[model samples]
Target: MELIGQGMEGAVYDLGDGRVRKIWFDRRPDDVRPLKAFLDELPPLPFRTPRIHEITADADGQAVSEEDLLTGTALQESGVAEEQALDAFVAVVEALRATVAGPASKALPVLNQPFWREDLSWGEALAALVRRRAAESRHHFRRDVPDFDNLLETLTTRLATIEPDRLSVVHGDICQPNLLMDGPRTAAVLDWGFYSTAGDNTFDAALAAGFFDMYGPDAQRLDNLLLDRFERLGHDRQRMYLYRAAYAITTATIYDADAGDGHYVWCVGNLNRLPR
Candidate 1:
């Protein structure tokens, strides 16, 4: 088996003959449950996502999942121009959101870890995640972001007071890496690893913007471009910070490899630095 990709929950490997196995390290079934459930509910997207069929075990006894390997170049590794890819990403998100538009709970029946494993209000779920991450990453947060403690305090306090008024189906993690560029204007979405049952739909766009801003060679230009585009869509540009902050904290711990990769560092740098 050749290692194709790795994320917080598990590592995916190519098993030849167009089959891939994603084996979880923590051996947690919660991650796999949501992924399978969410994909089943999506109304025929324009792009391809893996079709998971079975869960078994590897030779060493790790919990392994089998999926039919869909074909396309991953956007993050494709060396495509940022502007072009970003536009495709936004298009895919909009299309997917439209596909699943419905009453909140019926929209996307996916569960996220630590926060939304149950039917909780948005405020309750987000606050749970924030508090958990703040405690776990106190040292990393303090060292990286300016005013980590203050940011933590402020977010934890503010997040608890709010509830989502309108909810749409959301692909909770739509960062650049989850997209695959199949054509100039088309993209294949992969990795429905986490979907929110009740979520703020606008936050998904902001999450993609964060990925673009962090990975771009020039930060300011991309930031301004995204701000203009999202603002035009009537997204509350200011509230993006809150969404971005919650996203950063929950995902920073994934794929850290005990701090080898700089992902956690990158996430921390953007944790609470709202646009000026």
Candidate 2:
């Protein structure tokens, strides 16, 4: 077996003959089963998404599954000019908006359950989740804020103010590594574990845009792209800030097994910058 990729939940390896095996490590395959189904329910995207073929246990006692292997260049390793990759990434987000167009938010499965937050309305539940995560890893993280609990209250209160009149599928993580591209086009959007049920589309946009600007290709170009898309979507700068903070905190806590990761530190620093 040739190792190709690894993430928080598991490691992926090539099983030969157009098949790839994913062996779960830290996270259980059963926990993310609903998440994968959520991805399949979305409307056809502009890129290929592999369908799961079989699920079984690896010899090491981890849940394993075989799925179709994508042939395109993983965008992170594409080695193209930054501008080319940046444009392709933004275009994919636009296509993703069209892809997840569907019926009522309440109709979706993993999205419909409201596990993202208690109410999952604007982002009150999301803010709470972040705060809970922050508390869980408080021992690990060096607190940057003077009053962390107050920030949580502020996050929840301000997040509740925005009522999304409409909901769209939110790809929980939309960045270069999750993309498989063929030239300037996104050939596939891989990694479906973080797919959301429904939320303000702009919230999704902000999270992706912030991610690109912070750690992805063409950060400078994406700054304007981020601002323009948010403005066009009628999501104010303040809303983007709120979402970014929540996202940062969430990422920080989730990755706290190692306090030395630069991205994890970046996430914590951004979460600290949020105001009460």
TM-score of each prediction: 0.79, 0.81
Model 1, residue 27: distance off in Å is 2.8
Residue lDDT tens for model 1, 1-276: 999889867888899988888888866443355556555655677777667778766666667788888767777677778678778767875765565433433433333444454476776677787777667777777777787788877886777776656655667777667777765545567766464554676777777676665755776577667767877887777677777787778768666635546678667766746543
Candidate 1 local lDDT, residue 131: 79
| Cα shift from native, residue 184, model 2 (Å) | 0.8
Q: lDDT tens string, model 2, 192-249? A: 6454556666666777776765754555467667657657756577787788877766
Any runs in candidate 2 off by more than 4 Å, and if so which?
27-29, 59-61, 99-122, 138-142, 213-225, 272-276
The 0-to-1 C-alpha lDDT of every candidate, in the order given, reads 0.68, 0.66
C-alpha positional error of residue 3 in candidate 1 after TM-score superposition, expressed in Å: 5.9
Task: Report the Cα lDDT for residue 106, model 2.
Answer: 31
Cα deviation of 109, candidate 2, in Å: 11
In model 2, the worst 10-residue window by lDDT is 104-113
